[model samples]
Target: MASLSLWLFSGLVLLVGLERVAELIVSNRHASWAFSRGAVERGQGHYPVMVVLHSALLVGAVAEAWLTDRPFLPALGWTMLVIALGSQALRWWCILTLGNQWNTRVIVVPGLPLVRRGPYRFLPHPNYVAVVAEGLALPLVHTAWVTATVFTLANALLLTQRIRVENDALRELAVMS
Candidate 1:
């Protein structure tokens, strides 16, 4: 049962990784669109770090689950799975709402109006909310508590800096407009 659960969890991680690839494809296209509109990218320094940490998150969850022989508690696992799925939904909502304005990098086109639809209607950084939820829920889906803990802490710090850069860029855009 434990091995089967591990295999299942591994498959889940792979699917999520594939989803990330799809996101990157979309993000690249959107980035090109933004650049054509004279987008100014800020916070380049943290982009690679963000990529590494997110990749590590998937790897860590699977490694920890396999290494520690973590058993799937149906109660916790199912609940976490739902939350993780919900987070994905929220992330896609953000992407679709932002449309061509969205990129994995903080590339904001000057003179473009701010987005306030979908999840953004409620929160200044709704995508980060999805990120936080996924960081916690994905690992917990297979009881990778250590991965969940470390990722949550690291992501919180990353987001603190990330949000500041984003807000600064937005403020600049507002001032320009």
Candidate 2:
């Protein structure tokens, strides 16, 4: 049963990784569109680090689960699974709301107004809320507590910098407009 749990968790991670690939495809297309509109990208230095950290998150979760012989506590696992799924739903809502303005990179077009729809209507950085939830919940789904802890801390730091860059760019846009 424990081994089965590990396998199931592995499958879940794989599916999430595939979803990331799909996001990248959409992001690339959106990026091209933004560039055509003379968008300026900020925080390029952190982009690769963000990619590596996120990729490591998936790998580390599975590795920690398998290496530690982590057992799935049905109560915790089921609850976390729901949270993780909810985070994904929120993330997609962000993407759809931003439409062509969204990219994995912080590319903002000058003269465009900030999006105030969907999740953005409530929180300024609603996508980061989804990201934070997923960072913790995904690893906890299989009781990868160490991975969850490390990722939550690292992601918090990264997001601090990311939000600053985004806000700065948005402020510049506002000033220009």
Candidate 3:
């Protein structure tokens, strides 16, 4: 059980690291295009803090999973794994759809229209769905219910602000379209 926890934590850390790298690359590309297009950036204050909090949640989940060694039902682990994978898929889909537009920060491309196709056609915030799924199930995969519950509650609060910023930015873009 301890070994599993270590491995799970390590894998998650690596996954997050890679995701950050992707975000940086995408943001750099977006920056060049958006600036050239005279896009104004709005509400960037909470972005860095949010990134830190999200990373902390991943690390905390890993720690809790590693420190505790309660035997989890195999069925539960499998179910959580499935949910986690689903969340990852959703996240990657968002990344693909947004391309250079997808950023971890609050970057607004003034003249560009808000995305309404793909998953966005349904959920206004498909990224939020991915976040919720991840916050709930990632820790559960290792039977770290404590981590899951606490992080989910925290993320809910943080997401409220995040969504508000995103909505405002998108709304600004919507006026032109």
Better structure of 1 and 3 per TM-score: 1
Residue 105 local lDDT, model 3: 68
Residues 1-177 of candidate 1 have per-residue lDDT tens digits of: 458889999999999999999999999999999889888999999999999999999999999999999889999999999999999999999999999988889999988878887988799899999999999999999999999999999999999999999999988974432
The total of clashing pairs for model 3 equals: 0
The parts of candidate 1 lying over 4 Å away from their true place are 174-177
For candidate 2, lDDT tens digit of each residue in 50-153? 99999999999999999999889999999999999999999999999999998899999888988888998899998999999999999999999999999999
> Number of clashing residue pairs in every model?
0, 0, 0
Output the better candidate (1/3) by lDDT: 1
Candidate 1 TM-score versus the reference? 0.97
- Residue pairs in collision within model 2: none
What's the lDDT for candidate 2? 0.94
lDDT values, one for every candidate: 0.93, 0.94, 0.77
Better of 2 and 3 by TM-score: 2
Worst 10 residues of 2 by lDDT: 168-177
